[model samples]
Target chain A: MATDLMSNGNRPSAEDIAARRKVIEVDRLDFAFGARQVLFDISLDVREGEIMVVMGGSGSGKTTLLRHLVGLMPPQPGKVKLLDKDMGALNRRQLLDLKRRIGVAFQFGALFSSLTVAENVKLPLRELTDLEERTMDIMANMKLEVCNLSGFGHLMPADLSGGMMKRASIARAIVMDPKLVFLDEPSSGLDPAVSSALDDLILKLRDAMDISVVVVSHDIESAFKIADRITILDKGRILISDRVDAVRNSPNERVQNLLHRRSEQIDVDPTEYLRRLAGD
Target chain B: MANPAKFFEQIGRRTASGLDEMGYATVLFFEAIYWTLTGWRQRQPVRIAATFAAMVEIGVAALPIATLLAATIGLMLAIQSLYSLGIFGAEQYAFIGIALSVVREFSPMIMGILIAGRSGSAIAARLATMNINQEIDALQVMGINPNRFLVAPVLIALVVMMPCLAMWANIVSILAAGLYVSAELNQSFGAYLNDTLDVLKVDDVWHGLGKAGLFGIIIALVGVVNGSMVKGGAEGVGRVTTRSVVLSVTLIVVADMIFAYLTTR
Candidate 1:
């Protein structure tokens, strides 16, 4: 039963399991931005159905890795492949096709400012498919409700708060019902309760749609709660890649430091801050 | 304790890195190009409307003004020519001066100056503000090219309207010049018009229109380049806009001089 639950050790493999395709594979990737060497020989894969979390601190090149996956910032020629295409060599039309297959939720939930929520969600449909008005409206509403935003279709992004903005962006992202989704810092700015609700949404979305997900975030509790597998990156390298339970039980000092919250503390004394400003 | 020679080498490295910033600007230019191209198509109404607004602001709004302003500048050139040639008792030769200067130089230069103030700075300001608000980054993540979507259309629109503006200016000014000589200098308007047409050959008009086109290209390039290169926050966008306007206008003037020098004898 433990083995059954282990389920291929929470790693993505190109093997057939219920006839679903593997979504992402990064093979011994060595990436750099002009000698900074952001990713060092990183190797990983994400299956067609699971929430795989890339956990790291702010500047740990996780975003760089995500950009590579989306082909926003290209990696060196031969290291990464998405949806079984040689992503490095795919021409514009092919790149567009693959990109359409995937959905991305950015850190700030980068919704188009000029577009209303419904229009933003309709963008992918307009670009890729020929769905009619009723169908488009129905599909858009369903995704909106999934993100807990049912009828706020006419609201612009500027009208949304941080939490709603992420929800709306997620709605826009998955409007196409993409086979794979990439989310960056979904829980970063929200309160804990709202953040957990977002986590639940991510898990439900993944399960219901059978969509593969690669989420980049540093929120430990959120990562553990939602992630089937977590790959921890440190100093441009994957420090540990394992199932959630394995990671929790492991005695690695860095892991322990993070889990226990014993790393460093900046105690805020209102008196001290006031005194410092006032020059006691 | 590296060698004394290595100290200069270190300074050279610093200089090289500083110069890498320009290369980064070039990269931003191409990045804007790439970003503007990759986006999935959007809903027709909003796309069409935003495009319409951009065209109206960059092309239509500026067209009549550019024409009228350049025409008036040409009229002033005619006035100055009549004044200068009137002294020499060769008021008919005023066409030689006004037509050549207005068609070959002033029309394009004034048009460029007008666009720099009107559309070029506006493009820079828009891109800068968009940068502050993360629209460009949003476009990138969504696989859209901000440059191709935003700047390219404006560039095309400017290129389209600039020639129209210059032609309008040419006609208005020639008419103004003929009227000026007829009323003020006691010369027949038809004789002045025929002389003007006779002296202003086809090559001269081509040369002037060609200069106007170059001016349009330079303004678009500088404005887009500066807009894409803008970094920092909201205040930074404003700074980039200001700098872009100044640079575009100055470059237009300098380019006009180069055009004049090149096309002259």
Candidate 2:
């Protein structure tokens, strides 16, 4: 795919040109669901061949941001450029064409219940490529092996445990050798041992395939372990987006609170509390 | 006075929602049509496999129920016509009434309603489950058009098989009615056969089959559109599945009425 020229049509500055080389870029993105604004002026970038972990509390708009990156949700008030093309400018065909180079493992694994793990992994290649069936099968098995799900390929999604299903979902996501992959809550429901192993697998995939990864997770240990950079969001706003060490050392109170898992004390007015209880 | 503003507001909301639903169904219908026509050029094996699977599910599987409905209705119609016409000493024309009604209206309408309830609800529920589970999103992320991958095969199956099912229903109903008239109603076999042949025309069969084909498209559109729009979870799936059945039956009935009027005219 040819890199699309920037929409501004102006010659980019040196720093701007450097930023263009990044695999994913979001500039002042704002998103709302109905009357509720969920992502407020969110800005971040994921550089090539790096894992960028997006961490947030529940309902902090991490999934919404991921949706925008993958073209499921359109930009509302800001820019999301992926793979050197403006996401807002692409037509349906162009968006789909661009999606071929991207992979997403959803929060729940999201494997097709009707198909076996092997068939699920083979779906991308089968739909988008002219590869022979034998070759496709071989490639699917290879991906399953990569995700440590080799012999489990013949089983239906219902047959797999949570960790195994997540692995299978990862296998399917990376089967087509996407240049960029998005993983949502990969460690959410796993035991620490399995979660740690998944973290290692994620890093291994990055090194082996040289693919950029954007992971949305609330698992502090997994994020700190796997991310080259981390972006922490709180209440639809980014507290900090920087390298792991910088994030850990940041003076921002919210960042510190999040890093230390501190829950702030609430000071509610007595009159307001009484009014709420009285249904006023 | 009752809240006039709220009453109008409710009416306006319902009208808008109905229009929105119609638009969604229309867009899905055209997308299914476009994919079905161009799908051959792409030669996607999965698509072809889905198409065949749908054929077996929608067509072959519905055969027994369709046959039973047709036979039962045919027998009832024959008995009713014989008793009613016997009052005027016109019992010999019972086969004519039975054949005409079965071929021109009952077979297509009954089969349409039955398939709408069975297959339409099934399609909606399956798609709603896929949606809730995020498999649909997974397909979209993989650059696969979900409509092309899922809806086209179903559209093709329903359209092609609906007429075939109607034809089967037509035959079984006529045969069942013929038997009832000959043995139970004390009419001769030769008289029943001759009366049926005289009353039934090629145009009648074509009209019924054509109506059945339209009903098939209605069911496909309602099922897929409702399914694709499903949100929430298991409750949403059940709700949309029921809605798909109701909407499909309503649309089939309306379409059948139009076809009946045009054919009779």
TM-score of 1: 0.80
Tens digits of lDDT, candidate 1, B92-112:
678788877777777777777
Q: Give stretches of model 2 more than 4 Å off.
A: A1-20, A265-280, B40-46
Per lDDT, the best of the predicted structures is 2
Local accuracy of candidate 2 as per-residue lDDT tens digits, A78-140: 999989889999987788779989999998999999899999999899888889999999999
* Model 1, span A1-280: residue lDDT tens: 3443343333343334325656788988778777688888889887778788898766777988888888787668346888898688888767767877788888887777778988888766764566897889889888998989987888998899899999988888898888889998999989988987888788888878889889998787778777777898877788788877778788888776655665443345778878988998
Best-fitting candidate, measured by TM-score? 2
Tens digits of per-residue lDDT, candidate 2, B216-242, equal 999998998889889899999999999
How much DockQ does model 1 earn?
Answer: 0.28
Q: List the residue pairs that clash in candidate 2.
A: none
Model 1 misses residue B154 by how many Å?
2.5
Q: What lDDT would candidate 2 get against the real structure?
A: 0.87
